[model samples]
Target: MKRPFFVVIVTVLLFIFACNQSVKVEVVTESSMRDSTQLVFWKNLGDLYGKAFRGTVVAGGDGDTTFAGELVMHVRLVEEGVIKVPFIVGRDSSRTWIFTLESDGLMLNHDHRHPDGTESESNMYGGKTTNFGTAECQVFPVDQATVNILPTRTTNVWWVELVPGSHFTYNLRRVNTDRFFSVRFDLTQEIETPGVPWGW
Candidate 1:
């Protein structure tokens, strides 16, 4: 049987990525039949790994602010086993989120850097996944450091939801608080990649 178009594309891209590596490459994908839900999620995510996703704010925070401007994300597998995705706002490019594999599960870190390549004081605060998320969804709850960053909030849950070939959403909420935000991107569309995010 023939492979799906997505499978073909992913395979080719991985091959290209593999060829350029001088070190022992860390492989994340397995045979299609044996791919786990997380692996599938990674694969689907990897498809747009180097592409730019532009989204519109469907929901905003505190009386409708911030996350209300143009939203763009450039997802890329930046290392042998790490993925760094940058969230670019209209003109400010100081935020990027990084993900890496841990012994337990995936760890998400907030990388808020200044325009001068310096780290922000309140940067790198995110959580790890405690459960095996499906291919379509995975949620990350705020960890200890995250709580310390914003003491008043009791909860900070960040989730990514993807409906293959249709839509992808990045959502965040603080339980029982006015901090709710959701941005949805059209998977069917591709935008030009923005400039390198602040601090590389």
Candidate 2:
């Protein structure tokens, strides 16, 4: 009888914990602060328009050795709440990161290009902010186009973070699979910009 009672108590505790988690998930603080925060942040990058930043992979794993080389982010265009930043990886200048203003959130799109200015076989996939994330950080779950392009990446997510006067980070994670990649850029120092990216 005591053994049965112990099992019942364990089950009740688990149910209560699950309920609390569910409530927390359903209720996240959605405030207007995110807009003001992102706006200020966007202006900060816009202030650096046309300037290219050079940094290194800093850290990553899982077949991402190619990404461990010198990294580049060219803030090529900024206009009317839209910023077009390209990430030139090592000798590969085929990736452009598009960030646009959404009424409700920010949008992140990976613009992959070829040497001839043509779109890659797998390109134009990313995500948009889904919540009122803090100004210093925001998360974007994989978009539908991304999942459709690479079904295996259905669980992928990407985010960019900026800590004023410190560092900027580009991160990717394949949730539920333990695959992760992160590249940190030193914001304190700006390096020389590379030549125009291919097809730019």
Candidate 3:
């Protein structure tokens, strides 16, 4: 009995040692997923003038998920010289007002423009856009502090990073449209979901 027990113990020990010899190990750190070399720059929004908004604003993600269209339309109000007031178009087609941003927290003018010479179902600014020619839209200024900050619905404005560099910037607008809609462009990436924050 003693000899059989001793043989069993020795065999188990040898098996454990052999398994350890062939074991492979690896270590991963959090910094591996972080990007330290990313550079972002922001350019002032020029006046966007066109005949129409073109096509629908589609929403997508870097992941494997998909969603329906969110932003149906948008408009802005441009005074002869004052800054243009940007507004959004809701799915229900109602023209909701937005608190325009001026130099400070003071309320500025609302965007009010329409192509059919009628009141816009969405926010309207004096600016114009054509199907063939390029439209004009003003770009908001971006600062270091405001670089990654998201938009506040109560304030009804958001700044998107049209162009990103070391100098992070954003495009300011009132997200009055439904939670899903947005403006799609080739410049930078714009993302939004039902419950996700405005800017991510």
Candidate 4:
């Protein structure tokens, strides 16, 4: 009789413990900043104004390895119609980034990889990048909310000027081992609306 009672007590305790177990759920925050149509316009503009730029990299080391590479950037309209750009840096050594403006804050996100096979990210004031790939990526603020450019590593203040109805010149530069290199990423496409609409 005592053995039967002990088994019953153990079964009841196990049932209670199982009943008290908690279930966890994940939550993701969605931006209420841009509406669907506007966001679509921005994405489309990014696709339209997207361009791929190629250049020669010259760096210093025991033995210099020269590489010719290309980068593709898709520019979208942001908060105040300022451009929000998402870009991929390379085919061999690549990093993807979402570039945007927040209030008075200029943010650059570097979603790169680590040697230990992990995802790594760097946040910058205007632009943030790491020297992981023998090259660095960056962005600069030109106006209060417009015409930013990512010049070469050595460019102190290279900027692009855009006058809506007229023509605009986008200037970019890169430097390796004190050698200033330059490349012009032409505006290959333009979209006044979002090209690829996603997100809630």
TM-score of each: 0.76, 0.78, 0.26, 0.33
Query: Which parts of model 1 are misplaced by more than 4 Å?
Result: 1-35
Report how far off residue 33 is in candidate 2 (Å).
2.4
- TM-score, predicted candidate 4 vs. hidden true structure: 0.33
Q: What tens-digit string does per-residue lDDT give for candidate 3 at 116-160?
A: 335543333211111111112222232222222422333244333
Give the TM-score (vs. native) of candidate 3: 0.26
**Who wins the TM-score comparison?**
2
The deviation in Å at residue 154 for candidate 4 is 13
On residues 39-144, what C-alpha lDDT tens digit does candidate 1 reach at each position? 6666677777788888878776546655657888888556755778888888888888777766466677889988898999988888777777877887888888
Each prediction's RMSD to truth: 15.9, 10.8, 16.8, 19.5
Q: Positional deviation of 94 in candidate 2, in angstroms?
A: 0.6
lDDT of 4 by residue, 84-178 (tens): 44443344333333445344333444344443435544222133222111111223433322223333332333323232223223333332335
Candidate 3 vs 4: which has more lDDT: 4
CA deviation > 4 Å runs, candidate 3: 1-46, 55-76, 80-91, 95-101, 105-157, 163-183, 186-200
Supply candidate 4's per-residue lDDT for 81: 36
In order of lDDT, best first, we have: 2, 1, 4, 3
